[model samples]
Target: MEPCPECGASMDPRSCDELFHALLALDHSRQAPWGPLHGVSVSCFLLQHPSRLPADDGAMAWALLHTYLEGGLDEVNQLVGQARRDNSHRVKGGPLRVVRDAPLPHRDASRSRFSVTIQDVAVDGTFPSSAFTERVKAWAAATVDAWSCGT
Candidate 1:
């Protein structure tokens, strides 16, 4: 396994269930501005790692899901721009593509807060068909639960 770019610790690619549970266990509130970016950076790193692709499809989905859930569209855009500019060695298919293709969460006009669901966005074509997956959908559902609980 290769060392994570955000943290020098070695990381192995995780399955969708593993990634979902791990993220759920984290105190994302403490992760703040940089924590979300760190996840994106790590996914990008795994995508570029010579060892293998590192199951980065799930990783990228997780990162993008959380970024949109927590920081909304602006933060997602910032991370996407960073990944595009910083990871020069990236190929055509990578986390950057996921970030670029994924839909940005929007605030519902009727609701004061951004209450839009992944399913709604996906059905409406805001989220590209390719980027919307079971894993990403699960993450978005979990995010909704977390937000409702005020955690």
Candidate 2:
């Protein structure tokens, strides 16, 4: 195995493959085949790459970033679901907000904006840093092309 120039560390293909699989598991799916890999995958990767411990600042930093991003995605989904529910509700509580362009007042006030202001609704939950939130939004938008919006 050749040394990774970035950190002067030998790159083990097996460990890299495991890391990739672990990353894939971070994506939310009802059929998440990877199950809970939080410590197991990290430990396995570190076992194969002894010189590259999981807690190494670089690796830990990436893990933190990954968790932050995953958390952000969950929040985005929650917001989207809240908006959907609010639209179906008989009263105000969730993501429903009044819009100036609407002709009807009651139901039109429940429409959600497909803009950054969607994050301003304050649905009661903590979030990652604003920078992480912005990155997650960008990631969602970019990946939308890869997902099917069909019935």
Candidate 3:
């Protein structure tokens, strides 16, 4: 199987479909303990699969990733809520205005993107809550690390 060109992660089903399903299961299942991790999971997935979004949405994804890397879900969620509440920036049904508000990084075209892949997130296995939490954190850290060099 071919790996993702952006992140270099190979999946059983191509083009990140399996990864989409995995994130859906984690975020949508009320009975699942992974709900709180939804933000971080989405951030990691979007950052890796930058093709999933347009440029502005991509900026929002990067913003979320930085927030998650800084303070986990709590920090990111707080920012999201604040974004929703700020009516001036709010769209009737569009992306949060925080995209415009956030301090976007300067990307160097000379530098290649993303050294970290979503491969470390482990979509197949059933992990206990604590283990999964640590795994997600590691994934976020690694992704952030890979992008730390002014990417």
**Estimated TM-score for each candidate:** 0.29, 0.21, 0.72
User: For model 1, where is the 10-residue window of minimal lDDT?
Assistant: 105-114
Mark the regions of model 2 whose C-alpha exceeds 4 Å error after superposition: 1-31, 54-151
Q: Which digits, one per residue and each the tens of the lDDT, describe model 1 over residues 63-101?
A: 565676667647777867776665667455444445444
- The order of the candidates by TM-score, greatest first, is 3, 1, 2
Give per-residue CA lDDT, model 3, range 25-132, as digits (tens).
867774445787776677677666656755565566667777877766778878777766754444466645664344544443222445444555654544346567
lDDT of 2: 0.32
lDDT of every predicted structure (CA atoms): 0.40, 0.32, 0.62
- Between prediction 1 and prediction 3, which has the larger lDDT? 3
Model 2: ten consecutive residues of lowest lDDT: 117-126
Q: What residue runs in model 1 are displaced by over 4 Å at the alpha carbon?
A: 1-54, 90-139, 142-151
